[model samples]
Target: MSDYLEMSLEQLQKEHAELLAFNEKLDRERNGYRKYAMKYAKKVQMIESLFVVPSDDHELTIKAIKTIVERVGES
Candidate 1:
């Protein structure tokens, strides 16, 4: 009975250590993913939310078209 009790205590200690390590790893991974998501979200807002589009004036549109054509030709 004493031997069985000792074995159980040892197994429980090992399990506790494993659980603590796993919890720390999960926390780090979650924080990394959250940081990456925030960065991606910032870029998405700039491009996808129409936040940086040019003005709708006719003169500006023409100039923009010319600039695009020039760049395309260069490419």
Candidate 2:
């Protein structure tokens, strides 16, 4: 007789296998995001290279550039 709060042996094994598979998929997705983050950082650096700040409003230009860089992923 199975206890009310206990899973059957087969069900328990199947759930364990499913959870393992899900965790593996999550790991792969995490790695992909890591790669993408690196790529995004490089792209931000490249774009920043093209930015020109006038001597008169250097601080304003810097603020604008920072905003643009932070918003790269939204577009």
For TM-score, the strongest prediction is 1
Candidate 1 lDDT over residue span 1-75, tens digit each: 235455677787887798899999999999989987776665545444342665667676566555554553232
Per-residue CA lDDT of candidate 2, range 1-75, in tens?
Answer: 445358978887877798899999999999989988976887677566656433577787677677767776655
lDDT for model 2, please: 0.75
The CA lDDT at 41 in model 1 is: 66
| C-alpha TM-score for every candidate | 0.55, 0.53
Point out the worst 10-residue segment of candidate 1 by lDDT. 66-75
lDDT accuracy of residue 65 in candidate 2: 71
Model 1 TM: 0.55
For residue 20, model 1's alpha carbon misses the true position, in angstroms, by 0.9
